[model samples]
Target chain A: MAGLSDLRAGFDPATVKEDFTLLRNPHHDHPLVYLDSAASSQRPDSVLAAMDDYYCRSHANVHRGVYRLAEEATSLYEGARQKIGDFIGAPDPGREIIFTKNVTEALNLVAQSWGRANLRPGDAIVLTEIEHHANLVPWLMLASEIGFEIRYLRLGEDGELDLSRLEETVEGAKLVGVTMCSNVLGTLVPVSQIAQAAHAAGAVVVADGAQYVPHLPTDVSSLGADLMAFTGHKMLGPTGIGVLWGKAEILDAMPPFLGGGEMIKDVRLDGFIPNDLPWKFEAGTPPIAEAIGLGAAVDYLSGLGMAAIREHEITLLSYAMKKLEADHGDALVIHGPSRPERRGGVLSMQLDGVHAHDLSQVLDSRGVCVRAGHHCAKPLMRCLGLAATARASFYIYNDESDIDALSDALGEARSFFA
Target chain B: MPGLEDLYREIILDHYRNPRNAKELESPPALRAEGYNPLCGDEVVITLLVDEGRIQDIGIGGQGCSISRSSASLMTVSVKGKTLEEASAAIRSFKAMMSIHESSLAPAASQTETPTAAELAKMGELAALQGVVKFPVRIKCAVLAWNTLSECMAKATDAQP
Candidate 1:
């Protein structure tokens, strides 16, 4: 609710950008204007140092070894769980936060473990047209096996979720899977309202927060979601680390997602007893170093403050939208909700006479890194009637100058193609 | 913008803006196959009419980037009246030109060179696409039409007997 000027007096983009080494890209003569944070954020020096400190000082497998090094490693890993839990306001850090390779795997864990145990044939699973394949495909795979009907919440002409038919969509659904924010459209869905609706229909709600948690302040309790999936890489942390936070009772009741060393209590000839709530879902060795890095990333974000980050991004988005509209006008068509408050800083633009690929190529020549494609949301692209879009997403490190560079490059691309 | 100029050559842009044979073929003798680049959502459908081992007519339909659309347009002209074997050979040569090892294979064939009359007649304007090898990601775009052509040819052969 606080404005950027009101939140943090010392919050500055130039200073904040210094923390990230990749922003100081030395390969190109032109400074790298990275606009692809929605794909994966660039890590900060503190996160890198944290991972380095772990591998250098304390390197051992967790939960199995009793040695001092192993004990230290376990503490660091568990400590990250507490930090991330606090960051997102999870109910119980130890019991609810399960680590996986990425959000895709985390969603798969929910579909395979929780969905399989809870759903039945003829049960319906509600989803949205804007969900990334990560959140859509797993449920589809489960639907094929369980014979559940998949109902879709359509995207409105305004690019936001059309909840006009919310009651009918979630009427007989066993679960409602949705993205908190669309990665392509940048439309922030009303998750709390949707969760309330789903609960009224006697269906649990699972949210894909891969694009939301990084940019905004997240509280699982506030959102009223039973389960949430997010990745570390999109939040200034390393890859190969994702989190699935769920209600402890729900996680405890679900079957294990995979059979492995750490996710078990005891193994016999006939069967194996699963471990506790969260550990039962985390199979094999976890991403120890990446977790440490994520913890450091959390620390960095907490230092800057999430509210400040959100405020900064909103300001940047307003500035960007105004600049783009005033400068390019009819030559560029920006997708999603026109109001900055209604969307995140992700701008999916269609330049006149320039294809997304060609636009991206031209932008790259100018050292502007914008993502161009379906962005793993092909169904959403189909809904928009576009084969692809050239997306430029903003983050904590980005500023007005980067957007200016992108605009200039895009102008060049359009004229070049013409 | 040296690299950019090479990738988006004037000839390539010409083919893209004014795509030749950009229509659907009547079905009786036309064999068609669809090709898609999942990464970019670029889709192309190639329709070929092969009669007695010769490609009598070729048509390309669908939408994509300049690289893909232009490639499809250029492909129709290059293989329209050629024998099926000659079309196949042209595809092979185009693929070879777009290969990552193209520099090692043909070190002297940079974009700066003006093609001899004989060489230009042999390879046609597709040689302009040779610059695509420098950009690895766009190579798939350059090859989508050729791949669809191969698929159409295979389907035509299968339809026989």
Candidate 2:
């Protein structure tokens, strides 16, 4: 079987891991084994340097600056937009990409601006059972105000979406909000297929690509999503910057989400003329340094090649799964698809009688950092009949050694509890 | 050994493995309050049986981590026979022991000036949880049951008259 060694022929995770200064944290006696990339990935030196360079060299608020330094800063920020937009295959980079605080804000922008204008009373918005609160809560909040019925696409016992009743679920739905990948379960939902179904049902497809875009090769055109949201931090970039990619016409049609400086073309005494497609949405003086950092992150990922990155994760995930199952047997139960090919490098594991909190504490002693909680998916937690699970997620920087450390820690935790 | 052992003390593990009053009290006699740690998905339900300004009986029913479940178990045992005022004092003392701030230790503020063996004995087994202050994130888990108990008492008081 192709493992990390076989797949990462030229790519060295150790070398890549070294670029991230946080990975070398001296707080623990043992080496830090960070497996919580699904939450927010650590930024590499290149990303950090890029942001630092921006602040040192081109320190100015974007969009309204006329000075040379301001222009340079604007170029750096917008240039990032173009690079990121191209990286994700946004149809029109200049018009489609809107920057927000994070994926949560991006999703909120869609819910508040697009959803409010389009949705009516008794209109349905189709959402998956496994969506993060970022994707789920916005629509729910909007529904309460707009009086639209929210329908959920339930997950099967196998942890994948039960799409057998897709047509029935999307019936009378105006918008279908779903996650491209499950952060907790690591199950990869076929976004393109879901989008096709949603489109056929006369519903717009809005995808939360917070998890997917980081690991997978994303092409918005092929995915057929009307709008998609993802954060920079999860994709090896800095926090406080997120991307909301939408169709140009759709973005142009929607009202400005927040009325602030850069988002306006003209503010009359009576009413205001909203800015063009993308700017109309990006209200405030955006995360300039963070966006530049995101641009550098994109460059780094492009250098590594997204396909190879995906392959590396698949190889590592498969190895981890096999090793864990062999070592622990019935003691450790992994959630999501049995096959690693069908999932990302996220393993939400349950160690029989050991509480996730207890397991996390024990693991922390060995310098293995894993998230232990409902993973902001309370609905999915209810579906799985679990209060919480210990989630160990991986990224391009992670390899088999980290997984081995994780397994060893889990064994120790089990013994300690026993 | 100091850190991990301090966190998962034997007493805490004992309470977690074998919880006290780990069942729902009959509704007519019990006033119930639910506590949820949304971050960890720890849900604790505390039921109180108050009789003439005293805690006649208490029951804890919930699903949570060892810290939370064990805390609930210990809380039920500690407050069972005490008057509401005394139980509240015990709660205050336990909270003081787990508190990082000097202000939170208001009830036993004078004890800080001179550490007495008597004050230590007053806390009893709840002193096992004093180590929890080190782990700030898990402190909420240790207090989930106590917070719920406070809510249950409030509800019971509100129901009267």
Candidate 3:
């Protein structure tokens, strides 16, 4: 509901850039033009300060100690869970959120825990062709072990999911996994619609919100996801922290993914009873400082306003697409949905005469940081008939000037190769 | 802080544009091996015919970046007429120039052990890829072809009497 005018009034990239120390420092000759938020976003000073404050003042192993410092650490760690849950509109914050290494771990936890418990030899799980390796591999690994059928929804020419066979694919599927946004194509998928179809077919929907949660406003319940996975680092938080949010009953029913320390209620030599909802899944020592950092990132993002951030990115996407098309014409191709509103701020592009790696190398020399690889979505890359793509994904810190720098560098790269 | 000029030399670009032996040979007569830089999905397939302990023919296949394609071209040309041992020596020598010493476990060896001028003289046009040593990540691109060639050579010769 937030307008572009609100974006201009409140959110300013120039002002935001001042908060990141790395942005001020030049990579070589030019200041760092980071457009790789989809891989991982740059952290602001506030997130860094939060982590530092935690390490410096209140560092302790969470949940066990009766001391005030340990209690404080536990509170900070649990408080982060609450804020992140609220940020994503989880129905039950304390019980539904499970901390993992990253979204990859989070997805694997779901596949190992809920999937192993539910899946059988005759069962089938529906997945999309455009899922990142994180989403696809876990399910594939699980299916390979359990000998269940895996059906993939095909991709359309316009980079959207081919949902014509959605009903057929989900007909007897136990679970349906879908990415909310394509990291390579920047395509924004209609999760709610997919969820509706999946639900109608009596299938549970597991959403990959890695690319979506960072840029768009997310309400997991409204989105109709039974369970979801997203990472902290891609949303201006530190690495080593990820989140998996599921329905309370679903998480409660599932067995523990990993068992060692904090995950159990009582562990005898013979058997162990798992702990309550969230902690039941969190095994061993958790990333406490990283969680606090994520809390700060959530606070920062909330202050900026998710709607305004989305609007800012939309404006940036429109500008960049128009400029690139006008400048390069047929020589350059941008994948995914043509309409700016239909996609996120990610641009997966190819130059006619140059390979993506070479193009990215040239851009790197110009202090532009775009990812030039399969983007960890090799199946999607293979589907697109590309070995790799030079991806430039925008974040809240990026502006039109960064896009201009990209355009200029692309021109230079083309001529240099030519 | 190596510049783009260091990574993409004119010779390297020339080889990339007009690659040598960029084809696949028939499977019965030629042995094939493939290499992949999983980081970028850059793949190189090497097919070669071995006869009387010498490489008779070589072909390059698969798709990759300018560096990888060109390196494959250069590698195919360099080892086409050499014996298996000689070709492996060339690979070792090339890897050495890239500061990947096979024997040393010390991390400092890669940084400190620069290829000598004598070693560079023996490498010919392949020496141009010495700049890749300065950029650690692209060394995989430069060496991808050699690695595949080594594999193909091993399998081809092993299949013979």
Query: Which of the two candidates, 2 or 3, achieves a greater DockQ against the reference?
Result: 3
Residue A268 CA displacement from its true place in model 1, Å: 0.8
* Residue A283 alpha-carbon offset, candidate 2, angstroms: 1.1
TM-score for each predicted model, relative to the true structure = 0.95, 0.97, 0.97
Q: Write the per-residue lDDT of candidate 3 for residues A1-418, one digit (tens) a residue.
A: 2335435737788888889998988777788999999999999999999999999999999999999999999999999999999999998999998999999999999899889999999999999999999999998888888999999998986888998878888898989999999999999998988889899988889999999999999998799999999999999999999999999988889999998899999989899999998999998999999999999999999999999899888898998999999899999999999999999989999999899999999999998999999999999899889999999999988988888999999999989999
Residue lDDT tens for model 1, A109-189: 999988988889988989999999999999888899889899999999778999999988899888999999999989999
List lDDT for all candidates, in order: 0.89, 0.89, 0.91
**Evaluated on chain B only, what are the TM-scores of all the candidate structures, in order?**
0.84, 0.88, 0.93
Off by over 4 Å in 2: A1-9, B100-117
lDDT of 3 at A16: 84
| Tens-digit lDDT string for candidate 2 (A1-418) | 2344744545878878878898866646888899999999988999999988888889898877789998999999899999999999997999999888999999999999989899999888899999999999998888888898999999986778999999889877899999999999999998888888899999989999999999989999888899999999999999999999999888888888999888898998999999887888877888888889999999999999999899888888888999999999999999999989999879999998899999999999998999999999999999899999999999988888889999999999988888
Error of 1 at A76 (Å): 0.4
Please name the candidate that would achieve the greatest DockQ relative to the true structure.
3
**Model 1, residue pairs in steric clash:** none
Worst 10 residues of 3 chain B by lDDT: B104-113
Q: Model 3, residue A124: what's the lDDT?
A: 92
